[model samples]
Target: MLHIPTWKRIVIWGLVVLGLVFALPNAFYSRVETHNDAIQTIEMQGSTPELVADRAAWPDWAPATLVNLGLDLRGGAHLLAEVQVSDVYADRMDGMWPDVRDALRGARDRVGTVRRTDAEPGTLSVRISRPEGMEEALRLVRALAVPVATLTGAGASDLVVSGAGDTITVQLSEAEKVATDTRTMRQSVEIIRRRVDEVGTREPTIQRQGTDRILIQVPGIGSAAELKDLIGTTAQLTFNPVVGRTSDANTRPEPRQKVLPSLDEPGQFYIVESTPVVTGEELTDAQPAFDQNGRPAVNFRFNPSGARKFGDYTAENIGSPFAIVLDDEVISAPVIQSHIPGGSGIITGNFNIEESTNLAVLLRAGALPAEMTFLEERTIGPELGQDSIDAGRIACLVAFGAVLVFMGLSYGLFGMFANIALLLNVGLLFGLLSVIGATLTLPGIAGIVLTIGMAVDANVLIFERIREELKTAKGPARAIELGYERALSAIVDANITTFIVATILFTLGSGPVRGFSITLGLGILTSVFTAIFVTRIIIVMWFERRRPKTIEV
Candidate 1:
């Protein structure tokens, strides 16, 4: 019996207390603001560069662990996505061959029947480019305003040749650089969240959880179709020429109306800039604030070219309203008061606190580099999370008490030593989880309970082995020594196999399952140490000091 010093016992108990202090705050992972009794944020208005958020309404502070938790545990939205890999190749070919159109145009004259599709020269639509003869067949197709149409074969010679892939280099370019931005997936998830938040939704969870998938879970949201619209659109941001008051008549009229919400309001139109004058990609920051007159507004800053173009447009259109359109909606039409130099300006509109916060989040996320298709979406409520916590607590209490009773009944006084070891094992596990800031879900709780059974199994195996050795005429001390030495191989073999499965589960499973695997892995490690070391120390101390007569049964 190796008695632990009083100081060692004190240190062990102190560590257990310290662990709880760190783990609880990390479990919640949210900071909500409630105005009066209702939820809200600071409502900012026009022109003011800075506005403080509502301190009284906001949560006291941020939590320690910001890890994403299971939707059922924390109440969030889940979205599954499918990215079209073929579209990636098509977009790449678009930039690589600007001269392909010239070759197609030349082919139309020679081929008797040639048609040009929107598909680039070497892509899925190259058959339409017949280089031998086709002026008669392809000439009338040009009259159609449609983007792409297939041509019929009306030629004696139809040559369809494919590009030699063996000669093609997988070279990257500036266009590819733009297409493959690191935040493209993050932006799409954000856009979907913004699209929902635009309608004033709250406490949404949006995450890029897979190689090419997004998970969004919005609490209290019953319908998610609107989210699909936001995620699906490319939301390409660009600078276009506003049809200034003087140039309105000169602008070419399209079939579409000016797209104003009210008939009485002045019409607004734009000529898409041949190349984007500046792109939203350069926007570094945005914030919601208040103006001198006190209306909701957002302040924004642009890169060099965007600032130059924005200043020029304001100067040219002084005293006339220039529409700030976003995602094709006329968001605001503030009259140009003066040239906005300094690369910064404010956008003013009739907005509430919800609208202001949402806009700020959207601008920060920016637009996705390409389109993403949502395959599935799910939402989990907070009520379910509470239910899970209650169930987990009940299961743990029942399993732990059952294990304690079984160990005490079977081994008598030796069971008391094992129980203490079990207690210490749990304390160490909790302390490690707290320090690491690991998330605990229902599955994770189950893993801990499973560990209790495994922990007792180690002690029970050793105790039964000692009983068998004593029956074979061995002394009590010799029996105890033989029991521990012989049981070591079996315990190691059993735990090592279980450890392998836990490792695989942690590596392959998603979210909650991974949490379960982590807890199980940690428990296996601590359980082996406590079952072998702590229990042995107690049993050895009892034998040495009291020289316990016959097994205390």
Candidate 2:
């Protein structure tokens, strides 16, 4: 008997209804998108009259999840940036200066008057007044070398210390350089992602492309230049002891000090100690606020270790000027009035509210490990994306119409049932995509079109099997039952193999390829359900109602 249990029938129909409900939002994509954005803004910032009106664009009880459009479909910025990993080497050497100087000072009698000397980038050179002290100095510096952390770099030291005559040169070892490069790339990617996400862009792709390169695609941003401005700013903030203030642009600083121009006052420069008392890496939180003068400023808090260092530095250096350096420039040099023990400080400069807010976002996101040079940049226009969307819609409609015509002409009433199931299959696919917040690209559209054709494969096999059964003089219900029973193995085997391929594509591919694979994989699951279960239930209900003694194929 061709029959479905009461519970099974209800479950099948219930899922179909749920899928349609979820898919309904995508039909009104712009309205649902605006509604979702308005709600998110209200949650993040606060409710406003305009925002409230926008939120009411869609029904409050209705589903608000819409399939996110990919960069290609929505139009946005694309960039290929090459990270300057070598830039970190100089900073690394600068950081190690304090340790090296302390080690040499322990044997001050042996290594008389040690001084840091200028050298090439990535290399640190130290000269001693007495040539005889070089051997003792080398031993002291070599002691600071630690084992590399990576497994492949086992037993290898992080620093390569070498000496000749009165000078000692130290640079990162080969293994350490490789490890630093990897860490720098990873940090760059994470920081970039944070910066982009801070702006609340939808589905931005930030991934490492090669050894030192990154690929960024942010949808809804104005241009590539705008995107670059957001992530390219190093935002390296440091607090250093000021050596002196000068008006000469070409002024020379003593060893271990740098001359940086003022951010507010033109032609004014401040010479500050190279080593900072605290860096932005220790920042725990940052927010936009107003200063005592009611000017826009950024407020920041440091971690425990930073707080301790800052407290001690301020306590000892009372009445001395402290330079707040941002990206190699001094933003302000204010005298230490008291021991600021809480580690909370304010940064005030010539800034508007927007600038203050942006600075706060950057500080909270943390600084990039290294600077990035844009190798390629492009801005995709929304008009072009709309054209692509129109073309894709046309292609899908054509394919769908052709498939429907062929099926209806070939399989008669059975084909009509399959067509209905196919429609449900597409709705279910979109529903799953929305639930997962999947991004839809142009290639993803092709996957849906392909799925429309493949959804009828099982129905075709079963209908042909029924035609064969009819030749054996079987009744309508008996032939239909045998057809489905015989076709089950074939349907499962075919779909299983295709689904595995889709999984592989998704695992190995990126960008558009990934979008395609996601749709294809989800479509396979939905098509199988609709073709096997939905169509079968429809045929069973029709058989029970008519009780046909004999039927044409």
| Candidate 2 lDDT over residue span 46-86, tens digit each | 68999999999999999988888888788999999999999
Error of 2 at 550 (Å): 3.8
The most accurate candidate by TM-score is 2
| Model 2 / residue 149 / CA error / Å | 2.3
Q: Give lDDT tens digits, candidate 1, residues 500-549.
A: 99999999886668888988988998788777777777777677788766
Best by lDDT: 2
lDDT (Cα atoms) of all candidates against the true structure:
0.59, 0.91
TM-score between model 2 and native = 0.92
